[model samples]
Target: MTQPNILELAKQGDAKAIALLLNRQLQPKGITATAALKDGCLQVILEAVEVPSQQVLAAYMSKSIAGLGAASIEKVKVYGRQTGTKVPAWNQEFEMAGQKLPVADVSETRSAISTEVTESKPLSLKERAKLGDVEAIASLLNIPLRNKGISATASLQDGCLQVMLEGDPVPEEELAVRVVRRELTSLKAGAIASVKVYGQQVGEDFPAWNREFEIVAQTQTVKQNNNVKLNNHNHTLGDSIESDGLQEIAKNGDLNAIAILIQKSLAAYEVHVDAEIQYGVMLWLKLKSDKTLDSQACLNRVSRILNNIQPDKIVSARISQINSKNPKQQAWNKYLAFKEGQFIDNTKAVNQMTGAFCAAVVIVLIFISVMYKPTSTTSSSPASSSSTPASSSTSNSTTPRTFLGKSQTGYELWADKNCVYVKGMTEGDLARLNTDVWRFKDEVKLQTGYKCVLFE
Candidate 1:
């Protein structure tokens, strides 16, 4: 009898069959594979006596399952761990269905796994660096980057590599970061999930600005440090700190210090009274009184800067803002929420609403101006209409008007209003009566008795 195809059986949600096929390829050098299908998503686990390389395992799985033509599997979530470890060190998810092929996820996954294959021996230097060996990685970077007059230091906190650069001309920030990322990636550093960079003058006491290069779909929650010295100041914001001065404190990842600097910025805006700063799983700022547009604007700008620079620290930001001193004034509670895989701030809704209201008013004014303009012709008194031009030559000199202006809107208008007598007219010309009237009022000072005769 012929044997059934492993790929076909695996597609039918046969976890054991998928595990067997994976194990056959993995070939057990103290390594093993297991799979479970959950909610139309196949999860594959890799365990080894020695920790396994997540990149190697994930790449192998993508090539294997993608070639299998498994339409039922919508996504594949891989978990890698040591044989005795309960929690997985490496975790990532990639799509699988309806694709010609699956490429390895280029985004690094968090783990402390070895390079090459899993063996009973000790891990290599590159593997150690992948597991957050700061000294090892820094030493490797020091040599290459030293000749460029850039000193490099790496710190791992909450799985983010904070690369502090002290150099001249502050090598282009993003380029600096990408080069660092590329270098570390080439060396297979798996622990550095994302990089937060701080650039400083070589001889300066502090960094002037800092930025954290964001990660694709990384967790937004920033882990808090219990070691920060919390302040217990009264309601009024203390000495307002300059935003530029806070850059270094923020770069140092000091939550309490950052909050203090934020308070200082608020103070400078004169909204210090009744301001409350709450920190923990989330950063919340409450402005109970004396909030002006300038105050709120400055606060929002500084807070957003902090959140963008250290998303891991300020994972979520919320504010209850009130511009008036009255305690009864309703406060606007705004939040930063995720939408379509990016953050959409609800606070800006107020600004957008104000802008839209102004736009609506302008539109209404334009509509009224158009609608109120007379669309039909007006008849003059019979006495004036019947007046015959006894001396048509005398009338020509009396009404010898100059061409003051002309207009075209689906019809032509030539105004000869030197004597406030608009001579050019047709049935359609009546539609432009309002425009001509306004121009005549300003330019020719047209009065109630001015006559406009039809020329056609």
Candidate 2:
């Protein structure tokens, strides 16, 4: 009469009896035997009937299990043992069975789940500084860091800003010095004061994400005012160059002016530049300094500005600077002497210089390529080219090329004429098409594509 009674009957291996009972069904239209079978009632019926493929009986066995009645089970808290240790265990109050329970008494196969209590060991700024968190170091100096109000969020730690978050979206162990550098750059540039550090906790199966605070050192307005006076003096000189022109400027190589300019540049702080760009620009600049131009934070800042202005232009300017004042003076004198010729076209001289340099480079490359010609001595060897066709054939036959939709197949990678054909398909053309397809797909998915590559 009831579902459980029917279940009991099915358990007794009554396929015919079960079918007969179902034939006398009295339930809603939405409920069906087939639905019950799909919902795993058929297996139960098979056991009851002691016969597999009693499809009709099994099919009729399923329906809303609410008819079977409610479960008797209720949640209970199994308490943990307290050892009265001094280390304040971070625990929280919990609720079970409509009753508040102390965390100490709550337990099961896993520790109690609840909100975090305050940390027992509050770190002093000095102690946090030793952890190499730069922001923490700044904090020790009484710097005020901005807080976004997310606990376990990243904050200042010490000499380096340490991300102390647990369970980050990214794996914690993969974090490296580059990340530290990036955060430091942001701190230096006043972008972010702190970040979340992610890591796994001891004796835990899952990772934890934690927040840290940022504290940066600040200069008193008075100090900034004094620096501004010196900055104004140097800035006037830079502005002077605009009106007076580079020609009228006397060349004493005023060390004081240069030093002031360098210092102000460092303090003024411009766009953020990463280490690689810093290194490359420094190499190209070939600065006349025993002062270690490659490093020194001032140069790093200047390099960032130079890069922002235009990396290629900066590189070209530096190359032009080689031979120091001699080439500069010569070029300036030549320009003055040949003022009429200079205006023939705006880029006439620069274009001539660039063309000359290109010609020289082409000559060198051609010489090297000829000397190292592929056929210079390799003709006697078995043609490696002969085996390429076989491998290509196998690749063509077995490659699991996916159609992957419109986003997978279209692009003009590089432009030219006449492309090599693959099985009557132009390989280069297809490659371009594939790149376009991927770009379109990435655009649709908000994903990055190789063809749509971006760099900073």
Candidate 3:
């Protein structure tokens, strides 16, 4: 019998037909199995040793039932039989055949699956960034900015940058304001044009508005030369230090030069100076006040001196009193979790395997079975004119409707008024296509994990 006839017979609860179909589908994938229609589901029993992971087996069964177009089959329950175990260790249910099956509440199974999936492939920085990786990006940004008393966190949403700086007992307002300004100015000219900076003292819900600033690409001009000069202003730090051309070096965007210049100028304050580039074109200068020095006073003096030296060249400049109590420690635990060349989405991997299996079944069945055709019956009637005109007359309109077609990648493609659908396509393939062919549309959720739809 043809594959369609066999599938139709299986729907009628013919055990032989169901077994034959299951064997035909599963055997080629190295899964020796038997199936029967029972209790409104396709009950599949697999040889324990032949069964792989539950997720892999679930995906295979889902794709197989979908291929058969068996709407009567509500779900698929898989059980594995081992030599010694009295009860099967592998028992899982998967929704199929248009049925709204309840999600399995197997927490232990899910936890084990998650651990297996995550440990198999840890995410790298580049891979995570491509997926808009939130945790990885935040960890990377926080690593360089960690210091005594102050901590910085970074988050990116839709390519917009948000940086939050927190200090215990709050830093001097003047210092916070300068730091926020410098950071924003530097980021505005980089690849990240939109930036929001927030500063808050530890234990506060709201940020200090006076210490906040925003920068957008449209309002800012890109500095062509890194050596742009800062405006000179009168300061209490004496003319001798001012005449040393510290402002000129700050304008050069040289972190080492800027750090040396600031250190020499503030040596009298007995502060420890450190500097680093926070982001593109933005430099961070940190000054730790000694016990004998008044932290707030030293911050004020540094802010005034730095603010005038490179006001225009610097994107932002801040001088803040680092919190003495419970300073936040920088730990890039997430970044460290990144293992190079080892990022894998378990779902996507399973989907690809399932798609390949389905595609193979489709190709094989197409060659073995005749294409299914609907039967049509007709009867001749005499004296149709005497009957009602409406009964005899037929409408001849043919509305345009979307139908499945073949894609270059061997996926089945269909487009409706709202979205484009594809079967046998993996998420990775969909992502690559989204960047090229499906650039303007977003993906729509699909009931079948093996299929994907892009919204028009």
Best by lDDT: 1
Given candidate 3, what's the lDDT at residue 416? 44
lDDT of 2 by residue, 166-193 (tens): 2223333322212332234323434344
Computed on alpha carbons, the lDDT of every model, listed in order, comes to 0.51, 0.27, 0.44
Q: Considering every candidate listed, which one attains the maximal TM-score? A: 1
Tens-place lDDT digits, model 3, residues 89-112? 678887775544333322112332
Q: Which parts of model 1 are misplaced by more than 4 Å?
A: 1-116, 119-131, 135-161, 164-209, 212-344, 347-351, 354-372, 375-456
Quality of model 2 by C-alpha lDDT: 0.27
User: TM-scores of the models, in the given order?
Assistant: 0.24, 0.17, 0.21
Model 3 alpha-carbon miss at residue 406, Å: 99
- Candidate 1's residue-wise lDDT over 1-456, tens digit each? 122343445656555556655654453344566677888788988766456788777776776666556667788898988654568988888887666674322112212122455565565434556678886566545533554567778888887888888889675454455446435644555566777778788888788567665443322222222322223344222122221333323433445445555554444344432323356435565554553333345434454444333422334556655545555343455555423222346556544554455445446656875786544224655554454543231221334333334333332222334233333333233323422223333323332233442121
Higher-TM-score candidate among 2 and 3?
A: 3
Q: Ten consecutive residues with minimal summed lDDT in candidate 2?
A: 332-341
Which of the two, 1 or 2, has more lDDT? 1
What ranges in model 2 sit over 4 Å off? Answer: 1-160, 164-301, 304-456
